[model samples]
Target: MSDGITKIKEEFDKKVAEIKALMKNPQQDTGLLSNSVDFRDKNLIYSNSDGVFTSSKDKIENYPAKGYPYKRGVKLSFSADGTTELEVEAGGGDDLYGICTDIDEFTGMATVVPITNNFTGYLTFKKNGNGVNPGDKLHFNAQGELEKNGGNDKSVNAIALSKVHKLTEELSIVLASVFGNRALKGN
Candidate 1:
């Protein structure tokens, strides 16, 4: 009957829409192939709350941006008031939360790409008193810029992935998950 065919077509369309939605947020669609080994073993990156493909180990969440139009790759901190704030102090607290991925101009929301073991993005580092070399352990400075860790007291957030000799020249860094804890040796 025509009615039966129409119902089937409508069901098919609904299923298709569900699949597309699951692809966008696979974690929420636990009914599909989420339990399959193929999906688990693939280590596939999934879209986060901001529709950004992030490592399966990390979750990028949107936050109310205290200031709109944050530069991509700038360090962001979670404030006590529950808004994401731009870093301004030097080693104040464990304010080093995540990096800014994207911003919604209309909503003034910032997508925070969490720093996790799977994080492989590049970070810009600032030159310290002795300059920076590859393999140097880095910590956040006054402007949330990476600076050489003078000793074990500072949190080793990242390791320099490139060399920088001049004040104007900037370099990239890799997140130091192994030694990223704050005051690992002193405390």
Candidate 2:
């Protein structure tokens, strides 16, 4: 059964790659033009600067550089001044910046959530005030950790995704969906 699943996955990946290649080079087959139209109608694909179709439309807008493990709901951007390595932005200086979504750390790359989508990640809830839950708003600390509003933290970001529940009263790491503001334009 495992082998069957693996084979199915491999074939699916191969077909997707073929479709991507065909989309990249439309001249390969005029029939592919119609295929692209069909694909675009069904998928919410965003074009990268390089003009290549991405593997998934969900979390990644395009392929991440090697060793970057951003799955879904997170986008990456580079700090212009080089002062900050990775930044999860809540508000862009222009007020176009969205909100916090996920809490995964990649040392060499900057990450952000999409302005118009819902994202989920494992985040630590605040231990203060009986702790946080699915409907609570959150902010990211300087260290890239998520916390509730009302600290030195200025960003009053909130969760857009629903979180799973645990019966224990202790503060625990749980999966959560965060919403609002894009950290960067580039994925």
Candidate 3:
């Protein structure tokens, strides 16, 4: 079976190389016109330093009008479970640290719930006039779980175990398939 698969792959590679070589130099149609104007009238008018001419007003209107201005700002949020690390940053300012549940100055309190069994959070920054932009890091702690300092660590452990259980089942199937092929070859 391995030999057959290798032979098929070699033939496929050869065919692809042949097709690529055929497409290298395509024949051009002589009937098609080569000479054409690359610049548009609107682009030519906008490029002029002197500005656009007005017929009735007897004045030149500058490219950019006065009304347009740029506006900008920043915001951050975070979450985690079990034993997870959180990082916080204010624009041109100090970095802050805390657990998933613990609140920071930017995100006042825990409002959003965890989507998965794991914890999740986001840091969002925005320009006032435009839409929000994300910070460098957006993270979810897959191995971590929500935990109280003392009690209820067992409950968090149980949730983490459940996620591990699902992953183990998937990995087992993949390993079985890989090893099964080796066993068959040995036979």
> lDDT by residue for model 1 over 1-187, one digit each (tens)?
9999999999999999988865755576676536565534332422443233355656556666654323223345456675556431122226555655566779766666555433434444554335666677666554555667786666666565556444354533433322323334321
TM-score of candidate 3 against the unseen true structure: 0.14
Better of 1 and 2 by lDDT: 1
Ordered by lDDT, highest first, the candidates read 1, 2, 3
Estimate, for each residue in 1-187, the C-alpha lDDT of model 3 and write its tens digit: 9999999999999998898776543344333434336573333332222221212212211111111110000113233343333322222111111112222234342221112222222222121112211211111112122211123222121111111112232121000000100111100
lDDT of every predicted structure (CA atoms): 0.51, 0.43, 0.23
TM-score of 1: 0.47
Indicate whether candidate 1 or candidate 3 has the larger lDDT.
1
lDDT of candidate 2? 0.43
Give lDDT: candidate 2, residue 16. 95
Query: Which ranges in model 3 have alpha carbons more than 4 Å from their true place?
Result: 24-187
Winner of 1 and 3 under TM-score? 1
